[model samples]
Target: MLTLYRPGDGPWHRLPAGPKSLVLLVIVLGVSLLPATWWCAAVAVGACVGCYAVRGAGMRDLLRQVVTVRWILLVTLAGQLVFTGPETAVANTARVGAAVVISGLLTLTTPVSELLDVLERAMRPLAWLRIDPQRAALTVAVTLSTLPVLARLEREVREAQRARGGGRSLRLFAIPFLVVALKHADALGDALTARGVR
Candidate 1:
């Protein structure tokens, strides 16, 4: 299922998923509201590093999370630099990067089952609005599981393109990537149907 949970006996790992998720939400919101300043960016990134250290996660694990979103961060920085200035660009990129790291830490410590349980329980209040908590939780689970799959598909497509001397052509990359993604979606739908999801 492409679970990212890293088994550990640290305090963060022992923390309940509900509280951990709430803390993550608060951190993300706080980061979003902070001004685009170098100090703010440094503080945000520093907080994430502190959290990782407290959680006993290695620098390598944090680096892996950063690497996963390197391209996105670079593009964001570039666009901001052109539209705004270097200061705002770096601050915004750090803000986004910190948020991603916080999220990765949550998933690293909490099991998928625990997260789904928390999500389901949290959605119970919405049942009066005809919202099915189970279905909603299942949807979230599927979405989370699909992200790694899509990432893998993207890497494979890029590698194949390069092998055929396609260089960095977006068109060549997008075409095969989309096709494979659609195929994965169709298969996932079939599996869900077989399991009586609907």
Candidate 2:
């Protein structure tokens, strides 16, 4: 699986995944509710940075994850600016960027197996409703793993287009990317079946 976990001997890595995940959820909820003010944004961003530093992750590692969503952030900022004015847009962007960084920090610190185990355990209560916790956890794991694959595929397609001196064309990229993604999904499904994951 394409997990963001990096092997480290840091305290964050040593922490129990269950509690860590709970804390992550709490932090996300709290942050999401904060007013989109400059100070709130600064605190949110600073907290993420501080957490990374405490966990011994480098700045470049954090930037790598954050940069992936730059285009989305840009578009969001543009729309907010047009609709709500510059101050709100800036605050909103900062709020969003901070959330993304915080999420990335969590994934970077926790291993995929640990995350899945925690998720399955947390969903155990749903068993009373005839819901399969393992299946739900596996689905989430697969979805998380697929994101990096799609991101890498997009980057590869972009690079290939540039190499061929092609103009910016979504049409040229979308079809092949979709085909590759579908094939990847099929292969992933086969692997999961072989492992008796679902």
Candidate 3:
């Protein structure tokens, strides 16, 4: 699998995973609680960009995060434009983009193992409720790891379609993407099972 963790000696990279995750959660929650306005969205997105700059992330890295969710943003913008107005559409799209960028930054700065460790520690108190902390952490690990893989798969599929002179058809893209994603899921399941994760 492709790792999202970028090695760096930056402050974000040096910070412990627990507090970093808490800050991420707080930012997302705070943004969600804000009114859906252009200023709110702009502030959220601008803050994420500033964080990237502070962490010494290049423009390319920031663009990659935006590119990965371009389709989702387009759809959201279009839908909101139809139901609401252009301002709301822009605000909502920017909010979603900001959230994705923040999450991407977290994954880029923190290793999967560290994130899993934090999750496991946080979940320990729920053991009496029949919650398996290890399993919970595993689920998060799989999710965090799978996002980049899926994003890469999407780009590969899109390139293949372009090579075949195919246009941007969602149905065409979805079919092959889902097929490959399921194959990857199956292989991952087998690997995890072999390691006794199940």
Candidate 4:
């Protein structure tokens, strides 16, 4: 999956990070709320396309990037088709698939720093709840950063497994990844503490 952040200086980069985070939730909810009809999906797609364009994204680039998560999108679409009536299957699947792509566009347009800034801002109210806002923001940052780290490790491990013909064994793959993730998680916690984010 593509990350939501990149170094940039566009208008999106200048916008308050707090508002952008809410947008992620809005995109998913708005997409899911539409009726399972061809016209609705078409409208959703058009709306999403407009949002992307407003954020300076090209249609081809958007489509090309969504290829990373196509499998998940396909599975979702397939599930909707099998359960929903055949008459509405195509429309439903299209809507679901388009929604995923459209929502993903927000990530592509927004930088991850903006995300952490949003996280920090959003968690401010936690102080009233006796929660440490810095700790909360650090937690969110760790969570966000892990996806990329794990993806890197998985790619490396999968390559090594394929070399040794261990790729076919689910047990071999899962165990190593879990072990590495645990070790990394501990180190991350230590780093956060050292930085006084806790």
Better of 2 and 4 by TM-score: 2
The candidate that achieves the highest TM-score relative to the unseen native structure = 3
lDDT of 1: 0.84
lDDT on C-alpha atoms for all candidate structures: 0.84, 0.77, 0.83, 0.66
Models 1 onward score TM values of 0.90, 0.90, 0.91, 0.70
Candidate 1, residues 120-152, lDDT tens digits: the string is: 999999899999999998898778778767878
Backbone clash total, candidate 1: 0
Those runs of model 2 whose alpha carbons end farther than 4 Å from true positions after fitting are: 1-3
Model 1 misplaced stretches (Cα beyond 4 Å):
1-3
Error of 2 at 124 (Å): 0.5
Name the 10 consecutive residues with the lowest summed lDDT in model 4. 1-10
Clashes of 4: 2
Model 2 per-residue lDDT tens digits across residues 76-132: 899898999776787788777666667766667888888899889989999999999
Q: In model 2, which range of ten residues has the least summed lDDT?
A: 1-10
- What clash pairs does model 4 have? 5-111, 5-112
